[model samples]
Target: MIQIQEPKSPWEIVHMDWVTALPPGGDRSYNACLVLVDRYSKTPMFLPCHKDDTAMDTAIMIWNKVISHTGLFQNIISDRDPKFTSALWTNLHNLFGTKLSFSTAYHPQTDGLAERMIQTLEDMIRRFCAYGLEFKDSDGFTHDWCTLIPALELAYKTSIHSSTGKTPAMLEKGWNPRLPYDTLKKDLVDIHPTASSFKIMLDKARHHANRCMQDSFKYAKERWDKSHKPPDFKIGDLVLVSTLNFNNIKGPKKLKDSFAGPFMIKALHGPNAVQLELTGELMNKHQTFTVVLIKKLQLK
Candidate 1:
């Protein structure tokens, strides 16, 4: 299996994805969230947006919200969503010298950081709403989701991350933001370190975080490789593809064929994906697939 390169610095590699199809909230009627995750810190920025937002809108939003703060990222990892695949989005990043890495079809694990963060954000929202956390505006209209986002974001950033062993705020900003409880504490001292001293502390925290991340990756790879054997696929080999993600299949799923083709492997993409020589009927389908979804064809 091809190992994804770990980012060496904050905002060097970012993962972008959308959490769509939510109940409309707030004045602008936002029904979706644009999620951008920093791979190094595991810090996420959740921007409320519309589900039908186009590529241009997405680009503008990222420019204003993310790029304005972090300057520019070296790479962006995302799924093959139309907004990401569009010429506009591709060219915009290309002009800025940023590479866009698209994940293979039916594979969310390629951008797993964003996927996991979405789940966490959704769970937090559910729990908050379930607890009857609602607030009324000056006009007396009660809002649930829009009001909860800021609190959720703060809570997520302050919480210690498993892989990093430090809170995202600590890793990203070198300091934890003051919460409401901090205002009530009489013993709290407002101490601001010198710029050089603060920089040294931030560097040390990042150094520690990187080591923790490396350990986490090593442990995860060991656990995953135990159950998953990497398939040795060569060019020109005939293989059958799993139909688990195919949408064209009709009738009951259990009755349908589990595998399709005897398609010939035309090219290999790293060790985890391949390009198949597909027939005209399957022309519209994705030609590239992850190695886990393919098996060698056996003949008697």
Candidate 2:
């Protein structure tokens, strides 16, 4: 099993999640954790935080860090909890024209990638925090959650990923980090013969990974194409955009009610993107959204 952040673009489809739990002490009610994931590169930015992480706080925390580094994502997938659907959360996405999608209510597999990674992360944190409590600094004892999150994340990503047979670090950067293990003496290592024939083995591995990815995508697309009939929506029609926003939090991941609009179709791109014109705020928001978010209110 691999710990995967969504892997946005270089910066799109970023997934942000908050895990609530006890503070440094079981008595401290405020302790929670926040994690930001890039869907494309599988990179993670983590924060050790409190449960009072309301939607506004969540948006601010992300905006401050993510924008400083990776700018913005076109889409963000998160659960439809109060922290995500609060008006503050909606306004943030609207301000940037980013679309939000919520996970399936009862079925978490829609957001399984993030959930799995976070579960793995929490486990590691529990172990580290146990060890950290032993030390006293100067006058006081403390477990620095912020101090440890990065290292834990790094160790998790550098570890080999089973399905891809590569580390998340390597996948993101196209290179492996030189670790203490790598620096160990050759005599102390069981270095494979693949190391001796570097170029040849590297080529083989890349080819294999690429082929596997291609095959997976192909199979999924084929299955999706075969099972369902095409849903038809037309231009110049009223539609509901089923996406997650600050105040509008009710829907599943795949198909749900995200928005209600008397959207008139302006242009058709592919089998979707039924464009509409609006004078004020909503127009800019729609400009960033794709046709996949909308469904024809009246079938025609």
Candidate 3:
């Protein structure tokens, strides 16, 4: 598990991902959900979408659904989805003051929270559709799964989370929300804030949250450091690069080699990053690969 530190408050650090490639539904030809989660509060938004949605579409969905409500966030964590990796997404975030952090190649655990949420969301949608909710569109195509998504989102928001010991609704709104199952109807109450004291209280809350986050980060770093084997790469050494970052490889993907290789290491860019010397065909395809993506080649 990659131990990433948590942000101090809701929406400060967010995770965006796609729960995808499902059988199409008739409502809007929807086949996937764009999932966004706030790391601190664990509030999640599930937007119904198609598998082929472009990077522009993703940026628009996020701005309309998320930024429209919460204003601007500080950071976004996601996997190496093409949509997230695109230059458009990078520029959009830069225009807002948010930093984009992509999970390392082949290491999904770097964005484990979002991946786990997507799995849970899939399970919820599957169960909801299995309760005899199938329907036919005007053209007689089966339209079963899309309608239950709203209900699943509602239930997920109200349920108490184990990590924070509070429902996302409570953390986001500062109170527990009353569900439809409650016989007694509850009304929303507003509290009047005293002038300077409100700011003082807010400052104290932020201080405490920051302290807790630092402690959590310390524990996680210790665990990660214990199991991590440092990459002992040297200059002028030939290494095999992982194919997970390559998209233009020839031949059937299954038959393709896992690692494209014999690239000589020219220099170390950073502790874990490397610059490789590529000549011939691979030269135009790739230039630099991280040490994590390089494996030692055995000679017979």
Candidate 4:
């Protein structure tokens, strides 16, 4: 997030996304799809699955990828997608004590980061993949998925970061993560002095990243949510949610009917937030939401 500080912890403010493509040259992945990109590290983990995968399967895949590498974050902001709101999936996440926020139903700002990444991914996959799996061999096919993903990750990290003028990975780890490009940089000169030795260099980068983070947070917090306070949540309160929708629509949040709710508060979150279990009506249509957006359900 350009407005956020360099992340010091996973899910401090992470982005989530999904991507699709044809099977790597030789591989025959059923769904021709994979979920990639964790907000914290900005790393791509390919979760292979089929189009028929249920909300349970998708949630399990997400849990496997997240816990295996980053444990859990304080919050997860996702779009109002059916799979994200499925009863079984919601119940499981609640068990972990992670706060989940649904972006404005039709508002793209809910998951803007993921939307941008999707565009970049499409361009990358198209460039590396053959026309309709006509590649000469499996080697070439895998090169597109595995090799290209890492390459893109590195490229994205080393590029100009809007938040700190450093890569996202750099901010997260306090140093540029190792990648294929690091090995290829042997011929390069250290134009800037990080430290006299390698260990010292890493320490210096980390320190700088931390400093940048402090500075960034100072601004981010003041700007992150400008209201005087976080939303007011209470037990048994009825609330409406403002969700973002980025499917195929183009519009403004104010104009979007993304707000869906009036669900009863299952419990009050720490202070300014709450937990809501969709009612039979909402569940029948498949709904998911976090209480951060509640401004007190409009009275009858």
Candidate 5:
């Protein structure tokens, strides 16, 4: 497995992914969410989108919601989703000098940062938008996914992240953002400090955040190294890929084998990922599998 690098600054390396299409919302017609996570701050931005949106539409949302605020990013990590692989997406990022890295096919863990955020957003949307538990308008339920996203994003940003030991908002701003609870506080001390002092505090916060991130990385690497045993399979080995999400295809997933393959290993992509030469039914599908998901086929 490759070591994930820590970003030196917020928004330097952003991970992007899409959530599932839910019951369509009214007027806006938003049925899906575009999720982005900053590698450094672990801040997530959830933008409501329509399931029918084209590549251009996705680009426009990225421009408006992300690029407009943070400017251009240094890198974007994502899975090999068609929306991300399209020519429009490629040229756009190329224009901005933003490097695009795709995770090994069938290995979502490579983009786990954004995947975790997507899971959280999906859960929150189900809770509020699906259940209609949050608020109601004169016309009954709001049924507006777009309206619900901002609050959810804010909640995630303000909550403390374990890896950084600071809330995303705090890491980004060098101080916790004032919330509704603070508005009610009486005799609140002035936080406006002299320019030099403010600079010093910001520096201190960044230093502390960096230290926390380094420790988190070290612990995570150690834990991962402990249980992971590298496979001895080499080139031209036949292997079966774990059929974890094979249900996405048309099939009785439960009745089917939990693993599918015996495909020939064409090449090694990286230390922990392999390129497979698939044939028959699995052809035209994703060809790369992480080592964890691939099992060597031995003669009976």
Candidate 6:
């Protein structure tokens, strides 16, 4: 299994993914949402986007919604989406001194943070749609999807996260944002600390959050390692890849070949994935396969 390193500070690493195939909504006919999550603080930004947005369009939207507000981050982890893998996107990040890492084909665990966040966002949207709430934008235009984003974002940011034991706003800003419930209680008072004291408090909060994240990662790794073992195949090794993801294969799955190839390994991707020397029609497919989807072939 590939071990994901915990970030030392907020926004040091960010994970990004897109939620697509959504019903077209809003005046702009937005059909997708770009999800970006800070690896350290677990903070998220959900930007409305079109399903067919080009690489340059995605880059511009990210700049306007996230990078412009948070400044430059050190690294970004994402799936091999066309927009993320495009030369334009890679070159732009290279210019900004940011490293881009892509997860292995068919492996979402590498960008688990963003994937989980997307699930949460989808659940919220489903519930909202069920209630059939009517929400309007600042222009007084009714938007089916875009208008609900701000409220959903606020609810997600203000709630305590299970992994960090802190709310995203608390971890990132070092202070809990006031909620409407605070206004109902007369016992609540507004206390503003001095600049130096505020800085000290922020540092303490970050330190605590770091510890919490480390502990969470340790526990998760231990549990995962109990059932998963490291891959042993190396370069030039003969292996057989599972046909689970192949779509071109016809006939009943039970009757179809369970695995294909005796393809030779071209390279190793970390400890969990590998690149294979595939030929024929397979060349049209992704050559990289997760270790679980391939096994070392035993020669007769």
What are the models' TM-scores?
A: 0.68, 0.51, 0.61, 0.50, 0.69, 0.66
Model 4: CA > 4 A from native: 1-8, 20-49, 111-147, 182-300
Of 2 and 5, the candidate ranking higher by TM-score: 5
Off by over 4 Å in 3: 1-5, 106-115, 122-143, 184-246, 258-300
| Candidate 6: 10-residue stretch with minimal lDDT | 200-209
Highest-TM-score candidate: 5
- Please estimate how well model 4 matches the true structure, expressed as its whole-model Cα lDDT: 0.49
lDDT of 6: 0.69
Each candidate: what lDDT? 0.69, 0.54, 0.64, 0.49, 0.68, 0.69
What's the lDDT for residue 199 in model 4?
33
**Candidate 6 local lDDT, 98-158, one digit each (tens):** 8887766665436334444545554444443333334443345464546556556666677
Q: Could you list the CA RMSD of all candidates, in the order they appear? A: 9.1, 12.8, 12.1, 11.8, 9.3, 9.4
Q: Could you tally the backbone clashes for each prediction?
A: 0, 15, 0, 13, 0, 0
Reference-based lDDT, residue 177, model 4: 62
In model 3, the number of clashes is 0
User: lDDT tens string, model 1, 136-214?
Assistant: 4445556556545665566667778867899888888788888643344345366334433433333433343334334
Which segments of model 1 are wrong by more than 4 Å?
Answer: 1-4, 111-133, 137-139, 184-259, 264-280, 283-285, 290-300
lDDT of 2 by residue, 179-277 (tens): 543354546356555453443333333343344334544554565457434447665666666445523333455454346565666655443234555
Which residue pairs does candidate 1 place in steric collision? none
lDDT of 1 at 158: 77
